[model samples]
Target: MTRLLGGIGAQVLAVLAAVGRVAIFAAVTLRHLVTPPFYGREFLGALLNIGWLSLPVVGLTAVFTGGALALQIYAGGSRFDAEAVVPQIVAIGMVRELGPVLVGLMIAARVTSSIAAEIATMKVTEQIDALVTLSTHPMKYLTVPRVLAGLVTVPLLVGVGDIIGIFGGYQVAVRSLGFNPATYLQNTVDFLEPLDVLSSLVKGAAFGVIATLMGCYSGMNSGRGAQGVGAATKSSVEAASVLILAANFLLTGVFFSA
Candidate 1:
């Protein structure tokens, strides 16, 4: 039992060490955030890559999720003869919780994994080393733009997703559920305050930072060759997903808790 306990302790220590390394990387990256000689080209490119290109997917995800959520709420609420609350509930839930969380998770799977794999491949090909030899800082050149883009892009994406999601729920409620169009919409608008939307944007921003940081960190730390790249890609996705979900809880507390 002592031996087993010792092994578990060692594993826990290793995990903590890895997390510490990520924290150090984050601190170093943040230090460059306020410095001059900004990489405008990279930042703009990242904005296009991470934000503009991501809209269709994010919008689609939000629409379907909101529609499904409304349906579920209607079904459950009907059991209590409270189906009238579907539109309002769906609106609040989508903007406050589902919108940001779903968009964050989707971006984690798509953007985070892709970023990690691309960077890992570059690392494997010695591209990162070449940048170093050329006096180009990998952290600034590679990580900074992606992180900045995430900070700017994700919140926008989440906001867009929230709008689309509410629309989706509204559509389903009016058409399939036979809800009065004006009544449904009025209820949705009545319940949604400025704070609900703003909280979602904040959640999006945090999720974006968390996702991009995980991707950059895993890529930089990836070991040699194909196996390492695969490992890094997998790790980035896993970390981003867990972080996004955990962040949702925290953000919800901050936004909704009395």
Candidate 2:
């Protein structure tokens, strides 16, 4: 009993310590975001990597998800003969929840793993130490640019995802579900409030920050060698995915509660 209790207590403390470290890391990243000696080239590269390169995956995910969502809503609504509500439901669902959440998860899967692996490999190669030797802050050069790129590009990605997702639903609804194309488009546009759009973009920014920060933090703190890099990559994605979901729930409550 004593050993079990002690083990549980140690795990809890470790988790809390990790949370504290991440919070401090995030604070430091944000502080550097506003300071001098910004790395424009690195920021642009990160922007391209995190945003442009991610479009195909984001689009594919959004379109398929939107189509499936439409189909599900149609089937469910059919029980009550409320099938006509598909457009509004899809719009609200995508803009308010599905679009941002799915995009965040996809980013976590793709970008987070890449960031962690790259940084960890750099660490293994001693490039981070080389930066220190050259009088450069590793966090400023690597972490800040990636974090800023995430902040700037993720909202754009979310907007694109929301549009593509709505289009996907429109295609399914009009083509297969017998919804009038014009009416469906109108309904989608009419049903979406400015706040819904705002919330989706806001969620995008928050999730992006979480995803990139997790990757950077894990990479920076990763242990030695291949095993360490692999572990860091896995842990980064896992942590980002979990945090994104948790943050989504909290943001949803804050935005829609009342």
Candidate 3:
């Protein structure tokens, strides 16, 4: 019984310690963000990697999700002869929740894993140490650019995903479900409030920060060798994905739970 309790206590402390380390990492990243010999070249590379390269996946996911959502809402609404609500529901659903959340998860799976693996490998190869010996701050060079890129570009991705998702629903509704094309488009536009869109973009920004930060943090703190890199990559994606969902829940409450 004593051993069990002690184990539980140790787990709790470990979790808290992890949280504290991430907090400090984030704080230092923010500080570097403000004051820097800004690395424009690295930042641009990260921007391309995190944003432009991510579009196809984001668009595909959003479109398919939107279409499925429309179908589900139509099927559900049929029970009450409320099929006309499909457009409104789809718009709200995509913009308010699904769009940002899905995009964030995709980014975590793709970008976060890539970042972690790359950095971890670099660490394993003593490249990070090389950076230090060359009078470079690894955090400023390695972490700041990626985090900034995520911050800047993820909201844009969310906005794009929201639009693509709404378009997908529009296509499904008008083509498959006998909704008037004009009316479907109008309803989607009319039903979405500015706040819904704002919330989505905001969630994207938060998710971006979490995803990139976790990847960098895990990579920097990774142990040694190939096993460590693999572990870091896996953990970075897992942490980013979980944190993004949690942040979505909290942000939704803050924005909508009036």
Candidate 4:
């Protein structure tokens, strides 16, 4: 019993320490954001890379996912002969949950790994130090722009994905599931409240912050060699993915629960 208690206590302490570090990093970054010698050029590049480049992947993923979701819901609903609800269910699910979560995870996999590895490689090559020598603030030049871009761009990506996914579901339902095209669209429009879309976009913004923050943190504190760069890349992706899922749960609770 004592050993078990000690183990539990150690775990709790470790979690607290990790939270403290995140809090400190957030506070420092927020301070710099307000007092920045801003780098508009890098920020624009980050915006384009993160937002525009991410669009194709997000759209393709959404289309396929939404179509599949409509089929599954129809199948399950048919088990009770309630197949008429497919359009409504698909719209609600895609707008409220699937859109944000899928986009978030995709960005976590692609963007987080890329940012972490790129910055980690820079760190390993002493390029970060060289920036300092050139009177550049590494935090502002590197981390700030990426973070800001993620904050702004990811929500747009999520919104686009959400719309595409819904349309995908509509297409599948109408053509494959024998749903009346006009009726399906009417049901979808009638069922989806404005709040559902709003909740999705808000969740996207939260996920964006988590994904970019993980990448930037790992990169800024990376070690000095190949092994270190690899570790940073791995850790950043892992952290971002986990955080995306966890945030989804919390956001759902907030949006749907009394």
Candidate 5:
């Protein structure tokens, strides 16, 4: 029993130490953002990779989730004879919670793994050292651009996801659920407050930062070989996904608790 307790305490301390390291990494990265010698081409490439390339997956995920949510809400509402409320419910649900969370998780799965693997491989190849040799700050050249691009573009992705999701619900409702297209849209528009959209975009920014930061941190600190690269890639996605969900919960409570 004593040994088990000791192990648990050691694990907790290790986790806390890891978190502290990540925080310091993030701070250093942010500080580099305002410094000169900005990498415009790299930033644009990262924007394209992290934001534009991610759209198809985000759209498909949002549309299917929204359609399924509409069906589920409709079925449940029918039991209460409140089926007509589907539009309002769907709108609020998509804008307030599902949109941001789904987009964030998708990014974690796709972008986080990609970033970690690529960077870890670069490190293993000694490219990071080469950058240092060339007098280029690796953090500024590599990490800053990606993190900045994510911070800027993910909110836009969330907005797009929210629209696509609402449209998906609208399609299902109007085509299969026998909802009047015009009235359904009107109800959806009327029910959603500006705050819902604002909170969603805010969550997107937060999740984006977490996703990219985890990837960069894991990659920079990765071990020295193929197995290390694989482990870093795996751990980056897992950590980003878990942190996204936890942040979502905390943000929701902050935004909604009154």
Candidate 6:
């Protein structure tokens, strides 16, 4: 019993340590964001990599998820003779929950891993050290651009995902579920409040920061060699995924709890 309690305490301390490190890294990144010596080329490159490149996966995930959600909701609702609520439910679910969460997770899986691997590799090869040798602030040059791109683009991706997801539900409802297209769309539009959309965008922004920050943190602190890079990549994805989900729950409560 003592050993078990010790282990649990150790784990808790480790988690708190990690959280502190990440918080400091984020604070430093924010400082760099407002300071001078900003790198436009790196920021543009990050924008392309993190934002535009991420769209296809985000779109595909959202569409399938929306379709599946509609099917499930319709099936479940039919049991209670509440099938007509499909549009409203789908709209709310996609906008308030699924769209942002799914997009955030997808970004975590794809972008987080990529950033971690790339930066970890650079660290292994001493490129980060070389940047310091050349008087470049590694955080400003490397981390800031990616983090900024994430903050700017993830909300846009979430917005796009929400729309595509809703359209996907529309397609399924109209063709497969026998929902009237016009009425379904009208119901969806009428049911969604501005707060719902706002919450989604806010969640996206938070998730964006989490995903990119985890990647940068894991990479910058990685150990040496190929194994280190691989481990960093894996840990970044895991951390970002868990944090995104946790943030989603908290943000949902904040937005909806009365």
- For candidate 5, lDDT tens digit of each residue in 9-64? 99999999988998899999989999989999999999999999999999999999
Local accuracy of candidate 1 as per-residue lDDT tens digits, 1-258: 999999999999998998899889999999887776589998998888789988889999999988998899999999989999998899899889899999999889888998899899999999999999998889899899999999999999999999999999988988899999999989998998999989999999999999999999999989999999999999999999998999899988987899
Give the distance in Å from residue 171's predicted Cα in candidate 2 to where it truly belongs.
0.5
Q: What pairs collide in candidate 6?
A: none
TM-score, structure 3 vs. true: 0.99
Considering TM-score, which of the candidate structures 4 and 5 is the better prediction for this target? 5
Count residue pairs with overlapping backbones in model 4: 0
The sequence of per-residue lDDT tens digits that candidate 4 reaches over residues 1-258 is 999999999999997997788778778777777786999999999898889999999999999999999999999999999999999888999889999999999999899988999999999889999999999988888888888899999999999998899899999998999999999989989999988988999999999988888888888888879899989999888888888999999999998997
Error of 2 at 84 (Å): 0.6
Error of 5 at 151 (Å): 0.6
lDDT scores in order: 0.92, 0.96, 0.96, 0.90, 0.95, 0.95
User: After superposition, which runs of candidate 1 have C-alpha atoms over 4 Å from their true positions?
Assistant: none
Off by over 4 Å in 4: 1-8
TM-score of each: 0.97, 0.99, 0.99, 0.95, 0.99, 0.98
TM-score of structure candidate 5: 0.99
Where's the lowest-lDDT run of ten residues in candidate 4?
27-36
lDDT of 6 by residue, 111-227 (tens): 999999999999999999999999999999999999999999999999999999998999999999999999998999999999999999999999999999999999999999999
